[model samples]
Target: MRAQKQEWYASWFNTPYYHILYGDRDYEEAGAFMNNLTTALSLQADSHIMDLACGRGRHSLFLNKLGFKVTGVDLSENSIDFARKQLEQDASVDSSRITFDVHNMTLPYHDKFDAVFNLFTSFGYFDEEQDNLNTIKSIKKNLKDGAYAVIDFMNVPHVLRHLVISNSKTIQGITFNMNRRFENGFIYKDIEFTDGGNKYHFTERVSALMLSDFQKYFDQAGLELIDIYGDYQLYEYDKFNSSRLIMILRKQ
Candidate 1:
């Protein structure tokens, strides 16, 4: 008998435990990258931007604060809901300038945005390789001519070199035990956590894609890779040691 395969992100991303596990992520670091990226793009205050696969609209909100009209979209209903709530609570944010929606990245959106962003390794979870290409094509379809895109992903080589097999952490009284492995060209993380005497489990799998893979996909989608960065600080990409592979692409 074959084992059942599920879309891990759909379940895990919507879970409260998932947010708890990652709540300590560095916002200052993320904000610095967003700042540098917006400056590099030289986008106007009125430019429309799409935050594809935006989780909770953190980056989208920051971009909006910087004066861009932003739309943040995510497949996770809970995440979108949270983002909307956050937006409502912030009185300083112009409601008309920012919006959040539930969306699947593989679908088309048409020419509506001056820029599109996929940050925080928010890609590469589809079961079919074609779906990944479909996502790139959708990004292209959603952009106006000469519009730009930013994709922030893990550097496969760097991750493989620093892979930690197992670890445990306790957050908010919940103990999370995690195990990691690389198999069949995918890195898998298995998470088991206990909260309030209840045990929950989840897994995340991401394809170990190199720069060549992205170049091929971008070419097929009619996007030109304009620049590559190694980290949030915008250093030149070093395939051997970079902590991240951040590519800036432009739609032709």
Candidate 2:
């Protein structure tokens, strides 16, 4: 039997501690960005949208609230379960307009959505260069002709410029020690924490790909780069100064 390759995200993201560690994430900021983006694009009501890597359906819920039909796909079964439960329990959400599924982003889905979103620096997790490229190709195959796609990623140069080497924070009685480093074209983070008299550790790695790298992938995927933004406000891109590289691409 062939050995199954271990992916960092597969283990780290499945644990409940992952949610606890990142529980303080700025949902308000994320919601603001989504609002700004949908408004900017003038998304029509009832348009079909795919939230690629949609963890627990936070953004997908919001998108559905805005009247778009949303399909939220994540690699983690736990996250997909949580999203499904949320959709079932939430009274305000149009449950029929939202769905959740477990999926791998590197595989192609044909002609299904009017828009696709891979937000919050969700790309570049694969160790193989071709796997990373395959994700873009898969995304291209998922969209209909002339449909828009949004990729919200960190600006590599800006992230390195402002990189904090280490930090410690306590949440819900667990103190998490986090260390960050850049090496061999990848950004790496080591996280350690203790709870209930047990210690746990995990590592995260993502390719430190720049804007030009994404441009090349888009070209190879037969997608056209329509616009680039520096931040959620959608200001023009400034590689050195921007907090994010938000690319708006179109399936050509």
Candidate 3:
């Protein structure tokens, strides 16, 4: 049988240009968020964490540094390879405490974890709404009984309120032109650029999901929503003002 066609994310996320475009991400901020999150979750010192859609393993590595055993998975093989290479180059980290693999978030991971995290707006990429619910169910299947799961996503209202319709950024001598629009309950971002004598275009489509929408998905997936936060600081969520919609859930 012929192989199934890959999704847009599988192709785009695996590209070197994707890494270049996002290379300036704030790692310190990410680390601080992880610190606050692990503390808030009350994870044990030896807790096992599943970092779903953990591109390049930034959060996974930091979680490992915080004394947790971390399993980071992403659909991008290039990202997983990069994460593994970084792991091999870091001498102070105990390799046994961390692992990186390429896996689909919609499928149940084999090993159960004490806590599962889908961070940095990593959710809501599927064209079909059922896939999003499947991802939630998969997370439930990957968690031990009574364990916690977290999903950090963009606040749709806030994003739409502050949306810049068109913009451009120059990175690594490449100028990327970007345009964004919201239609049919999805946020679409079109990116165009030229590099190495070639022109490229990519589009990112994320469902504009709100708290109520997520509540329905969580309920359908047999998970209970325990808490809601607005940002990396873990403040109470405000529908219009917050930058992030962070949900903390528990398997029912």
Per-candidate clash tally: 0, 0, 0
Top-scoring candidate (lDDT): 3
Question: For candidate 1, lDDT tens digit of each residue in 1-252?
Answer: 536565779999998888889888887887888899999899888899999999988898888888889999999999999999988898877889998989989998644799999999998998889888999999999999999999999999999999999999999989899999999989999999877778888999999999999999998988999999999999999998999999999987
Residue lDDT tens for model 2, 1-252: 536686889888888988888877787887888889998878888689999999888899888888889999999888899889987798999998888989999997544898999999988998679987899999988998888999999999999999999999999999999999999999999999889999999999999999899999988888999889999888989989999999999987
- Report the C-alpha displacement of residue 194, candidate 2, in angstroms: 1.3
lDDT of 3 by residue, 1-252 (tens): 535777888889999999999989999999999999999999999899999999999999999999999999999999999999999898867799999998999999999999999999999998678889999999999999999999999999999999999999999899999999999999999999999899999999999998999999998999999999999999999999999999999976
Q: List ranges where model 1 is wrong by over 4 Å.
A: 1-6
Q: Which residue pairs clash within candidate 3?
A: none
Estimate the overall C-alpha local distance difference test score of candidate 1: 0.91
* Higher-ranked by lDDT: 1 or 3: 3
Candidate 1: residue pairs that collide: none
| lDDT ranking, best first | 3, 1, 2
How big is the positional error of residue 120 in model 1, measured in Å on the Cα after superposition? 0.6
